[model samples]
Target: MSIKITKMIAKTHCYIGQNHPNYVIIHETDNWAKGANSRAHATAMKNGNLDGTVHYYVDSQECYQTLEHQDGAWAVGDGKGKYGITNKNSINIEICVNPESNYYVAVDRAAQLAAMLLNQYGWDTSHLKRHYDASRKHCPRRILDEGLWDNFVKCTKSYMKKGTNAGSVKPVKEEEPAKLYRVRKTWADSKSQIGAYAYLDNAKIACPAGYSVYDWTGKNVYTNTTAKTGTQATKLKGLTPADLIKKIGPLFTADQLKTGVLASVSMAQFILESGWGKSGLTQKANNAFGMKQNLSGNTWPGSKWDGKSVVSMRTGEQKKNGEHYTITANFRRYPCIEDSIGDHSAYLAGAKNGNALRYAGLKGCKDYKKAATIIKNGGYATDINYVNQLCRIIEQYKLTDYDVKAGNTGTDSKPAATTPTSTTTQKKTFKVKVTANDLRIRKGPGTDYAFTGKYTGKGRFTIVEEKGGWGRLKSGAGWICLTVNCVTRV
Candidate 1:
């Protein structure tokens, strides 16, 4: 079918050209129903609705176009301009899948199209992104939840790189369906349980003991085995956790990898709070740690989880004289997992919490658990057992292994406070004329800050410190930095 183009599509500028590094971003129409296509076309160019358009749409068998290949589509925002590509550099590729649909034919088509785009642009599979990558909205929820996304990307990248292997693309195996299994909890297998579960299919069909027969959604998706097996792990060969590790682990930093610190907090915290970075918070918000703070009027805009439901202050009671913290339903979000971890570290660095103990240089403390307790008892959280839970998670998963191996291992430990330098011995300071029309007095002992009214260069102040052509002056707001010629102390 010929794809219809809106008038807005015609007027849109082609921001990106062949010269730009091309990227294909995947999205979902997010609207279900057979007539969704017609609705999309009619509403696309509506005056009130933003004049946005994607390159292609795949729905089961057909492809629709709201804009031509050359037109710029305002799809993703972040990482776009920063990467030297504008909105025009991205192609909005959408899949039309009804949320209620049983089979995801559109997903399959999207994967193929994504592969085609990668090959056509000579871009790697890493260029592929979900719509949510750029914004805080869920576009392709169905396919992502099904766990087919990883496989789809893997297949697409492989196909684009060397063309598909004839046997590799065979219709998904049916007769000898792979069975799903649940891990029976044991101390020995608990450390890497998530990894073990994720890679079960690739572990050679043998049951990992106590993991009874399950289908792809496992007991959660189906009522019984009599029904069709969902995404049988046993069907695909060459499936392994290493594949997932390669896809996910490398995206993290050395500090994150070695310290079991996924984002911030211990990796176990991410596993518990974000389900191993599978929760919408980590996937969408990049917020792996559920740290909450009300900024301006906006709450951290993403998703949240603290393993089970987090117990927060629900209501604040106005006692006749004071307010009491009451339990509430609130959680924190981050822009990305990286942001979440960075915020987590920043919080520990800033807040007086038990996490501070985890710092290796913390005087007297040796590890996270001990540090956690110290922080907890020192009133990190109001919760009586907050430290215990954090300690439990750390010990349960041996998360300290990662933190201990981090390059900044000893850095977190508290440093010896420096004794204030005596300003007794000093040199005669000279003053210089300000030649520039609009000169600035830096804040530190350098020429880096914009001068406030406090330093006018006319006032004679003592040169308390000097370094790199800048001098420190004692102003009303403590010591401030000024250029060498700005002031002098005789």
Candidate 2:
């Protein structure tokens, strides 16, 4: 069956039609608000609200063509810079998803669209690419997170062979859920690194030192298990040197604390770099550790920035000749120490700095020494003694003792207890359609409340309550204003 294309009106400047597309660049809408689907995205494109233009939006039911394939869309941010070839000669397709949409269906439709476009242009699966391959902003996050990008390409290839009626072209089957395995450096080590895989051979290949595999129900499956798998018998059984634990200990998130990045190593790095938070950057700008400005030149949507706030300082750089010299460089300024800590984590996690490929093996590394070694080898610092210095600080402070075993709780470990509070107020339920772009949903009924989320373009939502012209969403995310002419009752 031929894919239905709903053409959207667009500004003449939105795209250039002379350049024929040679590749298909894939992206995700990234909007998590309810009902933000292909039609909604089409509306946003027609209204001239989208920051950039894409050729098509593929949803579960239909594909909306916002720009012609012969034209160059501004989806990739290179803008005549690096990867400009794709931007000048590629078709961009955005797969839409939201709380109300079926993401798998959308992805399947996107695969079909990609295959059709490839066939039409006489191209191949080699022409497929994620938005990240062009500019590295981590677009199509769901596909990447689930390790489905390769499968997507394979499905597209299958579709190309089978023609438009390629619904039977199945993606690669997902691997069976593997037993969770924990590995530690020593029995005395308080924390262990966790990984999941199906086969014992794969688990053994991961270097089985102080390792134990657990079943789906969190029961140890290893015949001769020595590794601890459950909650600690005693809380804070081993304590780090109280004097060595810096004031920044509480800044780490629970997930970060358990991320196999030894708290001791991170703390020592912070103390050594920031001089116990007494540096000029720390005192003036709350930048406890020196992190350079993002050199990628890509603006991620949710990242924090004031645009004008920055600090320049001289730092040591090691040359290929093994000589160190001081050079001035600009560093990021943070509003709080928390942001600095988060940025540091992101730096090591390869979220910033555009060097994710360099530090690919650092995540969930239980051994602090190995982590240090990886960081050093990943070119995190020019200092040849970086790993040694970090290890020395960790050993001196006994920081590994402070590391706690991660709980066996699933994805959302901290489940909140649901207790009904006293409430006699009545609420009427009604359906409403969002009529505005970028509508903010606040925690309360007023603008003064903190924004919980946002809706891009137009969408439909169920209002369960109304107070002073503010409507509370049935999803319980937050409240939106009904008084603002941006929403109408359905």
Candidate 3:
């Protein structure tokens, strides 16, 4: 017997194509009709005012036909085309029930109906989909959230695997596996340190000369629960610090304070390095970490407590290279959090020293590891362990949470701590091409002077004048081109 379907024709145009592959989309009526049949919807479709109809309907008891399989239907809208799917190549099936009914049966029957359709086209269960999948609508909301779709896929795959369709599943091509990379320590051989720990779970393994290892996800070499491996230790979503308020509370800006992790890291590291901001350098000079001094200038700005002598960096030459030891007197003590974060980022970024090396490839360094390494190897910090400690702190205390945007509000509008360029709003001017390259013009009507644009040798002005450069005089005004003008000593 041939399958029969009762369909509702909406006043909308049917969108279907013949060449496209057939896709079965299932939906729920979400009606309150008793016994799983929605008479109201059927009536609405017959009035010519109806919107659309599905190919078939399955209730708790029996199946009802709405439309013929071969006939075009208007259930799925044209918007599905946005997802590269067209209704012409698809079948829409609806299942009606009380929103509070046992939804599992609907999902099960939907899968069965889908299988029936799949058999017609010699297609596998993969061709079946949900209305939500067709477009971004939240229709059949309950079925999707209950994981019915995943369950349906599993059942379909299982049934297909047992039959002639077993070999029909897309074949998995065998290829070379990806190469495993090992992380290396920048100064693993240095004499100033005790050996670092190897894999947390694999006590039997030791780090090789150039490689350092960590297993945050416990992918391998982990047996004991005590080991800090896998996503557990590295996942810094939720961590509680004992001395959060006491150590780093006062130092955090409004933005930093908003992020719990960044705030915690700042507190923990500061306490570990400066002893609660009470260390000799911190108490007297406000140098929280006893960061080495390197400069000649005497005036920067700092409160003198106990006469401990403060140092500030001089703005003579930017981008210092290589490693220089001892305090050269160039360290500055920032009075606020805004300056500290900016300076810290710049100092490690090399961009801080006006050296582009640190900023070269650091933009997408999401995790702290890459950012720290780039800073360390890029020669931003003299300390070899700088990157490691920074990365570790960021990991340990989840410092990213406390990441505050570097800026200020209200009375304390000190220019940001990083480069002065960041605070300055430079005018954006597009290059306007002139008829001639390197063309020069006069600054005044008396042939006094001047120059616009790029200097490619032959002739052109490095600067362009708007009005007074060449006013009214004679012989086409006093505007003398740079090529025609003679240089006069000012």
- Candidate No. with top lDDT: 2
Write model 1 residue lDDT over 175-268, tens digit each, in one string. Answer: 4322323332232443222211212332222222233323344342211123322122112112222232222332233434323333213444
TM-scores across all candidates? 0.36, 0.41, 0.32
Q: Per-residue lDDT tens digits of candidate 2, residues 1-490?
A: 3456777857654556665677789999988778788889888887888877788887655567888666777788563447644567788899887765557657867877888888877888888888866775556766754444655776677667767542333332235322233333332342443333323433334323345555445555563344533222121112222422423343342425545455556766775565445444554455656777754444433244455556655444556554444344567767666666656666566543463446567767768899888777876776666676677556654555444336633354322322212112238898887644546678975444556656534779989986534678898789876533344567
Q: What count of clashes does model 3 give?
A: 37
lDDT of 3 by residue, 388-463 (tens): 5555445544444434433533235221332111111222221222232222333342222322111222322222
Largest TM-score belongs to which candidate? Answer: 2
Runs in model 3 deviating more than 4 A are 1-21, 32-49, 159-490
Residue 111 of model 2, lDDT score: 78
Cα TM-score of candidate 2: 0.41
Give stretches of model 1 more than 4 Å off.
Answer: 1-21, 32-34, 37-50, 77-80, 83-85, 100-103, 132-149, 161-490
What are the lDDT scores of the predictions, listed in order?
0.42, 0.60, 0.40
| Candidate 2 steric clashes | 0
